[model samples]
Target: MQQDIRDKFKNYKEENVELSKNHSIKFEALLQQELHQNKPKKNYIKWLSVAASVMLLVSIGIQFYPNKTSEPIITKNDNDTTTKQITLGNISPEFNTIETYYTNSINLEISQLDLSDENKELVDSYLLKIAELTKEYKNLTQELNTKGVNDATIDALIRNLQLRLQLLQRLKKQLNEFKNLNTKQNELQII
Candidate 1:
C-alpha cells in the first residue's frame, strides 16, 4: 500500500502542466501601460498641490502684511498764530465749559476705577457702553458740523457726555459694593 501511494505521488509530480507562454509578458505590458497612463495624472496632481500651497501662502501674507502709509500729523505753530477760527465749542463758551466739565469728571471716575483682574470684565463692559455713547456723540458732532450749531444738537451732545459720566459713576458704585460683599464673604469664611 505504501508503494502504491508513492507511485501515485510520483505520477502526480511528473504530470506536465503547460502555462500560457504570453501570461507573464501580458502582465508586464499591462503594468507598464498603467504606469505610463498615471504619469501625467501624478504630474498634474503635483502641480495643483504646489499651486494651492502658493495661493495659501499668498493669502496668509496678505492678511498679516502691515500697512505702509501712516496718517499725517498736523502740528500747530504757535509763532505763526493767525486769527483763530471759531469751532463747535467756540460757538458757545458755555457749551465748551459743560463739555469740559463732564469729560474731566468722567475721566476722573475712570482713573479711580479698581482695575483689578476680578473687576476687569465689569470695567470692560462699562467701557464698551461708554464707547458706544461716544460714537453717538461723534455722529452728533458731525451733524452739528454739517447742519451748523443747533440747540438740539448741542443738547444731545451734552446729554451724551452726561450719560457717559453717570454710567461710569454707577459702575464705580457697583464695583465698590462687589468689593464689600467679597470682603464680607472672606470674613465669614475665616470665622
Candidate 2:
C-alpha cells in the first residue's frame, strides 16, 4: 500500500496538474478552521491571565488599605467628657512595642522592690522622683497630641522612658547596697 501511494504521488507530480484559481483562498480557509479548533485552549489561558491580574490587583489593594482599628479610640472619663489617648504606639507598631516594653520593665522593677521601715524614707524619695517624672511624661504626651509627631517630641518621649527605667534601676541598686550595709553592721554587733 505504501509503494502504491508513492507511485501515485510521483505520477501526479509528473502530470503537473495546475491549481484552481481560488486554491490559495480555500487552503487558507481550511487552515484557519483547523487553527480555530485549537484556539479554545489559548483562550482559557488568556482568561486565566486576566483572572490572575484581577486577583493581584485585589491583593495589592488590600495590602495598601488603611486599617480602622489602628486609629485612636475616644472614651468617656469620670467627668463625662471624651478623651482620646495618644502614645508612641499611635505612630507605629514598633513604637507601641517599645512603649509597652519600657512600661512593663518599670512596673516590674517597682513590683520587685523590697520595702521596710528602715528604707521607708528612701523609698518615699525615689517614689517622689518617679511621680514627678510621670507627671512630666503626661505633659509630653499632651504635647505630642497637640503638636503631632516630630523628631524632638519623639526623642524626648523615648528619652523620658529611658530615664524612668534608669532611675528605677538605680533605686534598686541603692536599696540593695543599703540592705547589704545593714547586714554587715548587724554582723559586727552580733560579734
Candidate 3:
C-alpha cells in the first residue's frame, strides 16, 4: 500500500511541471506580440517629430523673407491751392476774443459815438454764447445733484464752473467798457 502512494505522488508532480511549462510559453508569446505592436508606434512618433520640425523651419523662413518691392501712391492737382493754410491762432476763441476786444475798444475810442448796430450785434452774440454755456453748466449740475454726486468732486466742479463764469463776465465787462468809452468820447466830441 505505501509503494502505491509514492507512485501516485510522483505522477502528480510530473503533471504540475508540464502545466507550468505550457503556461510560461503562452505568457512569453503574449509579451512578444505586445512588444511587436508597440514598435511601429515608436517609429510613428519619430516621424511626426521630424514633420513638425520641418513645418516650424518653413514658417520661420517665410517670416524673415523681405519684401522685394513697394511704392507709395502719389497724385497731383492744380487746384490744391484753394485750401487755406490755418495758423495757430486762426480759430482760437481765446485769442479771437482778445483780439476782437482790443480792436473794438480802439475803434470805439477813435469813433466816439453811441452803440452802433454792428457793436450791438457783436455784444449780443457774445452774451448769447455765455448764456448758453451757463445754462448747460446749470443743467449738468442739477443732473449730478440728482444722481448723488460726491460732495468733494461736486465742490471742485462748481468752483471750476464759477471760475469760467467769472472769466465770461469779465469779458462782458470789458466789452461794455469799450462801448461806454466810445459813448463818452462821442459826448466829448460834441462838447
- Tell me the RMSD of model 3 versus the true structure: 24.9
Per-model TM-score versus the true fold = 0.54, 0.60, 0.28
Per-residue lDDT of model 3, residues 1-191, tens digit only: 34777677776854443466589889999999988774444578889999999999999998766423212122335677432322112223443444345434534543443346747776566557656655665665455545544555345444445544555555567677887898899999999
User: Considering lDDT, which of the candidate structures 2 and 3 is the better prediction for this target?
Assistant: 2
Model 1 lDDT-worst window of ten: 67-76
Worst 10 contiguous positions by lDDT, candidate 2: 67-76
Off by over 4 Å in 3: 1-118, 142-147, 151-153, 164-168, 187-191
lDDT of each: 0.80, 0.86, 0.55
Q: After the best TM-score superposition of candidate 2, give how far the Cα of residue 139 lies from its true spot, in angstroms.
A: 0.6
- Show model 2 residue runs off by greater than 4 Å: 1-72, 75-84
Can you give the lDDT of residue 91 in candidate 1? 60
Q: Which has the better TM-score: candidate 1, or candidate 3?
A: 1
